[model samples]
Target: MAIEHEQLERSSLTRYVSPKGDFIGFRDEDHYKEKLKEWGLSSGKGAKKEFLFKERNYQRVVTIKGYETYGKSDEFNTLVIEFQDGNLCCIHPAFLKEMQASSFGKESMLQVEEKDFSIEEQASETQEQVEKPEPKLEAKPEPKKPKATKPKKEKEPKIELPADKVHFTASVKQFALTYNPFNEENDEVVVLENVVIVEEPPIELGLAWCSHSKTLKKFELQPGDKLEFDGKVAKKKLAKGKDVEEEFIVDAAVQYKVNNPSKIVKNG
Candidate 1:
């Protein structure tokens, strides 16, 4: 099936302009390399291989146009795959690894329980019986009234943040993985607590998240280490099960995300 524009937007996958001036989704560089090693695809770029792509119930052979990265940053890459009709899609490297054994599109299937089918079958049978019509109606018992409960307080609106970079001070809460739906993978992110804007913006964020990008990796940050940096903040909600990694669940809500943090200083 052709990927929809809305699906790509909801996935929050990064799109970049290739050298050929075409826009495509960028894959994680580290993940691509790891999959390559695991799959023993050591021949590197421009290597052609056949992948069995499952379209609905049938499978078709597609050509892997090898892997390519954007610019010198080595942060993200993409696997170019050509379909039988000569169309190309920038696929996640791990996706190809997954297709090796199992049929593709398995993850995209809507799972329905057998009980649901049984219920539908019973309803159909009842409808057929109703067609003959001679059953007497019985008086049904009145439904019990629900108990009175206190109303829940409305959630506070998220604060609007400045577009420009702001100086910040925050301490590392922990290091953990956050789920990325687009890639169907977990990304390493730094969980920060006690965050505060030290400059003119004057924003105080109790909890936040930042991706463990190459720049942050250089510091080798640990839990409890205090950091000072400049970054642009945006309102991004982090859902517990959907966005957070299972093992590293935070008690507090995360309402903001920090992007492109730079000039980092670590302190005890």
Candidate 2:
């Protein structure tokens, strides 16, 4: 059977088989890598990742080009993919990726450096004063004073968080409980994003990209789930190696009680 020639909005990650059940697919190659990024799976040859779907130790994920769809849009919608383990996890009824590209949307701007135009004015004023005559000064004797001890006041408590807040909606990229070596229970992580923020010359280079959100361990990350979370974020500057340039993104943290579970419209 032949695959369709059209592209669909893959919510970054998909697992579906063809209508004929003869082929398994993920999104296109670019999207597959994106899915891996969301899933926290690594395709780097040296990177070791424990295969969640297979009963194997940490293995290298060697991705390969695969099928997408085998039938019409109404009849069957899927993306095929191949894994290094030969496990073909195909997602059915794939939907095109729909998202509102976000903007840095700076509410306020900070001018870090203050221009010194007053220095030039001060210089001219100093020159004018120099042309004038100087006044004579007189000196006076001072009296001695006794030294006194000052009392210290009690210190107040320190609060880390500010009253201002923010939240963003994100989809579940990969939902899996990592395999534990010693215990039966496993941990989970979910990666979310808004979109690529182009570099603006005026804006700080760090604010150029979309916010980088890590997994909030509130609950299981379902494939069709779009979670809205409230948390505090800090700006982080990550410098690449000498050859590579540095990149900036915000680091978000969602405490257990901080984020109340809420859902939004999932991309079809």
Candidate 3:
């Protein structure tokens, strides 16, 4: 019996760890769609088709099992493919498409050898330096000086967040793009200022980040617009790298992330 798309085994790529120890998975369903569009690849909704996958110096026939989304919010989505040997893996659609070219892995093999040669050269240089002795310099007497003490700055108290959803009031500070490492591009994110919890243990989050999701898009949020909503907040730091600030124009140092905002009310 032929396997159904719904019954296909999950791709192993969702849990794949990169060399840097980070998972190379999509952030959400939207993220996967964006990647597909960027690569000009289809959503893989039609019949399964066989394609050539380059492995080292040879090409192996592989069949597209189907595209699948994992996690509650489709946090990890990718194309699942089954190799000739029955091995299955989740891969980026763009990567799979590129493998269809005849010379996909040819240049990569040479690059790998060059990288290994460079590492060997570095090791030999390190050994030569270790065997060589350092020349000693004569020491001269110097006057001792008293060290100056600097006053320590007070640390800000951490905000306590509620376990359950709470009413929130905030003003849209600005709209900016944030770096999405998975896509190697910027994603639109809304920055909220003067955020406050309306319920007990009322806490204030000076700045918070919320994705420009469909819910917010419906409201057509603008800067300085006051908004009231019920949602949960979590501690998530906004990236503040020099390139991120310059390229994305993200000025605020957001300290929290708003999740699943609903009951949104625009208060002018």
Candidate 4:
């Protein structure tokens, strides 16, 4: 039969088929209907015919792609498997040869339905002799009791931070900066306090000049007019010819509002 690509239920793996009398593919009956619709069949088309054919013969096969059969051998029935990639095939033994080229055909010995048990009927006298006994349950004794005790005092407030505890603090401190040879552009540099070390090279060159000084010296930093200069600690030294090391302490040059000052206690 001609199978149209559009009519084909294209799966990343393989397709499936089963006899009409038996449920196939999925556990839900409605799932079959959904799959049929997905395959462009408003309802099952050739399936009914195929199903009837199998029911009459008492031997029908289910086929699946991308899966394998599981269970016993020496029987005609087999479970179709579709695992990864979703290939599934379930077919009767007769169609195995036809599906060989399709990559989803197989025949195996695994046909057998499990047996079920049946209850036998008994006469009225026999039923009476088989008495219904009363339920038997052992009584449980109560557990011994002791007087309630008071709880101990709460643990002492921890003076040390726990290993897992993260402590945070917001703090503010004053830093000082002073300029030497403030009037000579070539001789002037600012020193910062608490800032471990000031590199010889200034952050910026010719930032701004001191207007009041006769030399109108330029600075690496013109922090602002509000920055107070503490001239007492300002010092200058010569390392190489005409190269000077300027140093000073700045207090409160930078400030921040800290939420936890205790964090700084460790620095002490």
For this target, which candidate reaches the highest TM-score against the unseen true structure? 3
Give the total clashing residue pairs for model 1: 0
TM-score of each: 0.45, 0.18, 0.52, 0.14
Q: How do the residues 184-244 of candidate 1 rate in per-residue lDDT, one tens digit apiece?
A: 5566778899999876657788898987876688788889999999987777766454556
lDDT: the better of candidates 2 and 3: 3
Write the residue-wise lDDT of candidate 2 on 66-138 in tens digits. Answer: 3343321112224343454354544321111111112212211111112345666788889987866677686
| lDDT per residue as tens, model 4, 1-268 | 3433422323322344533334334434444443323223222253221221122112232333211222221112343433233334455433342322233323322221111111223455578788799888978878779879899899954322122212221111222222322112232222222321112331111111111221112222333312222111111122111343333232223221111111122222
Error of model 4, residue 188, in angstroms: 99
How would you encode candidate 3's per-residue C-alpha lDDT over 190-260 as one tens digit per residue? Answer: 88999999966678888988778755898998899999999877777775423555545665568788876
lDDT of each: 0.65, 0.33, 0.67, 0.28
Which parts of model 3 are misplaced by more than 4 Å?
1-88, 91-103, 107-129, 132-137, 157-169, 179-186, 196-203, 228-248, 255-267
All models, RMSD in angstroms: 11.2, 23.8, 8.3, 33.6
Off by over 4 Å in 1: 1-158, 241-247
Q: What lDDT would candidate 2 get against the real structure?
A: 0.33
TM-score of model 1 relative to the true fold?
0.45
| Candidate 2: residue 248 lDDT (0-100) | 17
Predicted structure 3: lDDT: 0.67
Sorted on lDDT, best first, the list reads 3, 1, 2, 4
